[model samples]
Structures are given as C-alpha cells and as structure tokens.
Target: MLITKNIKMADVIHMNYFTLSVLNRFGIELGFGDKTVAEVCKIENVDVDFFLEIVNAFVDKDYFPKKQLQTFSVKLITDYLRKTHYDYHQIKVPEIESLIEEMVKACYSEKENLVLLKKFFNDYKQELLNHTNREETVVFPYTIAIEDAFNSKTLDNSVFDLMETYSIAIFQNEHENIEEKLFDLKNIIIKYLPQPKNSENCHKLLYALFSLEQDIIDHSRIEDKVLVPKIREMEKVITKRFGEKK
Candidate 1:
C-alpha cells in the first residue's frame, strides 16, 4: 500500500468590494477556498467538476485556490500589480501629461495663471517620481523574486517566512500610506489646486487629476485587497509544510 498525507483545505473568507469589482471587470467568477468541491458547487450553482476546473484554472495562473476558504500567496501581490498598477500607469501617465499640456495652453493667455499651472505640474511630477521609485526599488523586485522562486519550483518554507514580514505585512502598511497620499492629492486637486470654473486651463488640470485619482484608487484596491491576503495565505502554506516535516 502507498500512503500520502492529505493536504488540508485552505479557508476561504468573504469577498471584499475590490475583489468583486476586479472579478466583474475581468468576467471571472470568485472561487471560495474554505468550502469543499461539493459546497462550492452548491454556492456557485455549478457542478463539482466545473467548480474544480475553475479552481484549477486559478492555480494554473499562480493564483491561490481557496481551500477551506483561506487561500493566499505572496506572489499574488506582484501579480496583481503587474496586471493593474503597472498597466494603469503605462497608459495613464501619458494621458495625464496630455491633460496638463491642455491646461497650460488654456492658461497661456494669462501669465500669472500659467505660472501657477507650472508649479502644480511640478508638484504632481514629484509625487509620481517618489511613488514609482519605491515600487521599482523595493516592492516590485521583492515580488519578482517571490514569483521567480515559485515558477522555478524551488519555492519552499524559507521564502514564505521571509515574505511574511517583508512582503506581506510591510507591504500592507505601505499600501495604506500610499492610499492616504493619493487621497491628499485628490483633495488638493478638487478643492485647492484648481479654479477651473474661472479658467479653462484650471478646468483641464482638475479633470486630469480626477482621472488620475480613479486610476490610483483601482491600483490601491488591487494591492490592499488581493495582494495582501494572498501573501498571508502563503504564510499558512509555509506553516503547513513545516508541520508536515515535523
């Protein structure tokens, strides 16, 4: 007789607003980890085979499968950013620049207003620089390492332990800080940065800020809701493996 230990099911928790929104946008159904194949089949109104297939698809894409309703992976943080934040900035930054230029043209007729717009752009430029630098230098690289470890099939307990504090926990706090800063910019754009009602240039600037804010919000949601939880779950895997070894 051959014997193999059974892997315990992961726990699935309730879906958050951000996760639901992302699922809707992607036309994907949410998978619950905590439930059994039969249970998820009942909840999702699908058969066991179909539910199992969907879960497999998520796993194929390096997404954690919710077993027992608790599914997570550290790499999910990087994956979410690659799909959402990186993609957003790749498109939004150019759009933002165009909008800023339009505002400059509208303010060209007023020298004083033109000067103010220049300063405003400078401020926003600096903010973008700081944000991108942190992601590139610290956040993205760590995530890439996690993903690489996973793909190479060398992923093990140590990586997960390191990530528990560095990538998962620290990054969660970082997302909160980033969200607050983005919120600050939104308030400034809406209430203080623009006199759009009085000037065409100001109007263009405010619109650009509004669009940028939306993009930032989407970016934040992916990191906070999807990525953080994934990392936490990976920690669980590490614990499980350790227990099994012992």
Candidate 2:
C-alpha cells in the first residue's frame, strides 16, 4: 500500500496489525483524533520521511529505502533496535517464561516434558539476550562510529581497518541462526508438546509464540533489509574514500 502523508494511523493499524509495533517504536500512541500520518508525525516531532520508510517497510517486506539511507541517521535505526531488544528481553520473553511456568504448574501430568520445554525456552532466551547485547555493545556502536566518522570527514586508516575487521555480514549470519532456533522452538511446541488440561493456557502459549515469531521475523527484516544495507552503503563510501587516499 502507498503510505502517503494522508494515510490515517488508525487506518494503517487496521490494515496491518504489525504496524502497531512500528508506531510504538516511534513512541506514537493511539487515539490521535483522526490525524493523518504527516499530521501526527508533525505533532510528535518525527521525521516524516523516516517514519514513512519504516512503516512502509513493515507493511511491505520488499520495501527498502536505498535513497533514504543517504540522509537517515544510523543512530535512529540503532536506537529503535535497542528499544526492541529491551521489549523482547525485559517484557515479552519474561511474560512468556512466566506463562510457561504457570502452565507447568497448572498441568501436572507432563511435568517432565514441561520442564524440558521450559529449559528450551530459557536457552533460547539467553541466546537472544546475548545476540542483542552483542549488537548493542559491539556492532551498533561500531556502525555509529562509522557514521560519525563519515559525517565528520574523518575517513582514516583506522576506520577502514575497523570496517574490514568486523562487518555487518557477521551479524547477518548470526541472525539466521537466531531465527532457526526460534523456528525449532515453535515447531517443538506445535508438534511434540502435549496439550495442557487448561485449554486457555495452551491457547495463550500458542498465541504468544505466534506473536513472538512474527515479531522476530519483522525485527530481523529491519536489521537485514534496512540496517545492514544502510551500513553496507556506509562501508562502501568509507572504503572508497580511504582507497582514494591510498
């Protein structure tokens, strides 16, 4: 869908539920009194183009902002990504873990199996936490450094060396592994886990898993399609600038 300035936020959320998360990243609360996208963004002091690009990308998987990368701040992308990490680690994952514990207690027949399932989830959670921490501690700061150096016209040998040593490609590869583990977790629950006596609990677990899977997919897409590519472009620019010096 063409997300022009006139599109209503309510209408956007109505069309695609995932856009709610996107809007939340921008700190956009609902109940905007029938405001257009541009109008709401104006009130929120958000960059209209960046907002459109992100929301559009969420709505359409293939939508990537190649031209917009030139002007967009890597910090903006990283900050949003960091917020998503916090959401997953601090809120969503803990909620699911608590639900699993509740389900285990509520359904005592398959205690052994439930315990194993909980272990699986805990393992996955740890892996995810580590992954996000690496990005926050290492990759994101490096990307920001590149952007800063680029803007300041400080393209030197050290920057080139940093880019060459550690690139976004590594993080992209790690993302695949993270996604595969999540896929396995979902399949294990769907295929092997016995149904809990409390149907409501089972349903809630499935719903949370489904929601988490979709969120992970969307999150990875933002990193793979938007963040990585923009960083790669920055890499190219820096590489060429350094090459000229050599």
Candidate 3:
C-alpha cells in the first residue's frame, strides 16, 4: 500500500493492522474525522517526518533508514517503548488475566483445566514484567548515557566499560526468549485447551491473545530494526573515538 502524507489516518489503519499501534505512540487517537495523516499530525503537533518513517516501517518491514534514525531521538523511541510496557503490564495483561478468570468461573466443569491455563498466563505475565523491568532499569539508561555522551562531545571511557559488561547484544539475545513464551501461551490456547461452554468468553480470550501477539511483534520490530541499529552505530562512533585516544 502506498503510504503518503495525504492518506487518511482511518484509511491507513484499514489498509494495515499495524498502523494503529504506531500512531498510538504519538498519542494520535483514531476517528480522526477522516483527516489525512499530515492533517492529524499537524493538529497533534507530531513530527511528520518521524511519524511517516515509523508508519512506513510497520507497513514495509524492510524500510528502515539509518539516516532517518540519526534524525530521530533515542528518548522518543524509549518513551514510546516505556508506554508500551505500561500498556502491557498495567492494561492489556490484566485485561487478559481477568478474562481468563471469567472464563474459568463461567465454565465450572472445566475449572481444573482452566486453573492450569490461568497459571500458565500468570507465568507468562511474570516473565514479561521481568523483561520490561530490565529494559527500563538497565538497557534504557545505558542507551540514554550513550546519547548524552555523544551529544556532550565528552568521551566517557567509563561508559565503554559498562558497554563491555552489558551491551545491546546481550539484550537482543534475550528478546527472542521473551517472545517464545508468548508464542507458547498462544498455541496452548488455540490447540490444547478445550472450548469453554461460554464460547463468547473463549472468543474474547482468543481475540485478546491475537491482538497482544501482533502488538508484541510490532514492538520487537521497532527494537530490532530501529533502536538496535541506532545504538550500534552510536557504539561504533564511541569505540572509534576512544580507540583514537590510545
């Protein structure tokens, strides 16, 4: 699909399911009164170029531009990510968990199996929480430090020491593991679990699972395609600057 600034926000979302989450990052609400992307962004005071780059990235997985990333700020990316974490932990995850409980109570005959399913979900939730916490505490601060050091034109050799110990590579490696558990959770619901009596509840759970899964896939793409490359380039610059001093 052609993604031009003239395209309506609602039309773009209809064209691609992923666009909603991307626009949500900029706090651009839907029902845009049929306003084009450019119009909505202008009203919302969002950066048009950055918004277009992000929207196009989701629409076309291979469309990431390193130069465009240079124009972008790490803080902007992280703030979006942090809000995504809030959506998962504080909102989406709990909504799913509550739905699962309702399904369990509604299907008293299958309480035993439903209880096990709830346990599995709780486990997944815990793992997700742990992963986001690590990003917020460890990974994000290090990224910000790199950005600050680069901006200040101060070569802090100490930051390199931190990089050596806990780098982006380490975080990237851990990302797949977090995603795998979510996959397992989805599969268990689709294949293994018996259909609850209240089919509506089961459908609700499945819908939530599907939506969350897509959101996470898009989230991971941003990290891998956008954030990782940006930080890696920054790392190269910092390493070269420090190497010249020796």
Candidate 4:
C-alpha cells in the first residue's frame, strides 16, 4: 500500500520498519506522538510529498516513481542521497563488518578462508566508499550547480565552463559492478565454507550481506535512473545556450 500523508506516523513505521532509516535520514525524530505523517513532516520541515514517495518506494520494491522523483529539486534528492551515504558509512558498513568478524571467530575449520573473506569484503567496502566519496565531492555538487544555474534568470559562466569539462554521463559510467563482488562473497559463505562452529553467526552474517546488497541496489537505481537523467537534461539546456553564446 502506498503511504500517504494522512496515515499516522506510527502506522507508517508499522507498514515497514525499514523506513526507520528513511525517517532518520530525513531528520525526523521519534516522540511525534499521534501525529499523522504529514503533521510530523511539517514539524520537521520536510517536504511531505517527497517523504511519502521515498517511504512508499522503500516499503514496496516495485513502487519507485522515477518521473515523480525527477520533479523534485536536486538539493532535495541529493540531500537524501547524502544522508543515505552517512547511513551506509556510519551504520550499515560497520554493522556488516561486525557480523563478518563474528563469522570469522565462529568458523572452526578453514578459518584461513574467513580471514581471506574479510580481505575480500574490505576491498569491496573500500571501492564502495571511494564511489560514495566521488559522488559527494564531484557529481552531486556539479548536478546541484546545473540545477541552480538552469533556474537562474542570468547564467553563471563558471557553471557552464564546469559543465563543458565534466558531464553527468561520466558519473553514470563510473557506477561499478560492485554487486557481482558482493554476490561472490555470499557464495563463498554459502557454498564453500565448512559448517561454522556457531551456525547462528554464519546465518546472521549471510543475512547482513544480503540486506546490504539489496540496499545498495536500490540506492544505485535512484542515481542511475533519476538523478543522472535529470542532470543530463539540465546540461542539454545549458549546452544549447552556451553554443548560442559562443
């Protein structure tokens, strides 16, 4: 069911607890006693429609409204994406690391493989972090500038110059196939590893890996499908005017 503003804030949590991260990222704190989703969003000063779209997409895998998402300001979408990066770094990544550490400890035989497994995960983690860093430092800011300059009555030559050198297409192409690396890690644990001494920890470790993998997939879809195209359109408009100016 698509979440709407009139839905009670607590009921939205009941709809899908995964939205806890979504809510947290929006800077919506708890203790919004009896407030509807719209009321809480208003108090927190969040865009209610954007919040609903994000939450609905989170709850239902098939519910991403790409056309609608593109309608939002770059700052809104990028701000949410930045918060997601923080969630991955400060929370999800560390949680996965801890699970791996536990699995390594719980492996009775072929412990050496788990050590190697740790290395594999760390390499993937580092690659993902580097990708996130690039978006934070480079892609997001450039896109925001495009949006800003596109909307302004007078254009900024600096924005146009920067656009000439770097395009959103570069960011789109740079999206690495990290999912395969993550799938390999899962296969190693499921197929290759000996029965761990603590089977529960092994199960927990696998579950964590799966969860992070899914989250990354969803996150990438938003960037590749929505954000990049929006920026590309803005680039086209700017490029046309730039050609006229020249």
User: Mind giving the per-residue lDDT tens digits that candidate 2 earns over 45-117?
Assistant: 8888888887777777677645664467899888878988887887778888989999889876878988998
What's the lDDT for residue 244 in model 1? 69
Which scores higher on lDDT, 2 or 3? 3
Write model 3 residue lDDT over 1-246, tens digit each, in one string. 658889888888889875676777688887788899899999999988878877777677677544675568999888878988887887679889999989878886868999998998898888888888988999889888888877777778788888788777877887765667667777887888888777898888887887777777767878887788888888888888889978
Candidate 1: stretches off by over 4 Å = 1-80, 108-117, 140-161, 179-198, 243-246
Model 4 C-alpha lDDT per residue in residues 125-220, reported as the tens digit of each score = 899899899999998999899999899878689997797789998877877776788888889889987766778878877877877777777678
Q: Over the stretch 1-246, how does candidate 1's per-residue lDDT look in tens digits?
A: 110112212321131222232332233355555545355445555434433333333323333333422233444435444544544455555666676666666553454654665565567656666776677677777665565554454446666665665765776665544445446655665666535444655565556565556556546554555555655565556556556667
Provide backbone clash counts, one per model: 17, 0, 0, 0
Choose the strongest candidate by lDDT: 4
User: Which residue pairs collide in model 3, if any?
Assistant: none
Q: How does each model score on lDDT?
A: 0.50, 0.80, 0.81, 0.85
Off by over 4 Å in 2: 65-71
- Taking all chains together, each candidate's TM-score versus the true structure is 0.52, 0.89, 0.90, 0.92
Candidate 2: TM-score?
A: 0.89
Ten contiguous residues with the weakest lDDT in model 4: 57-66
lDDT against true structure, model 4 = 0.85
Poorest lDDT segment (10 consecutive residues) of candidate 1: 1-10
Query: Which residue runs of candidate 3 sit more than 4 Å off their true CA positions?
Result: 60-67
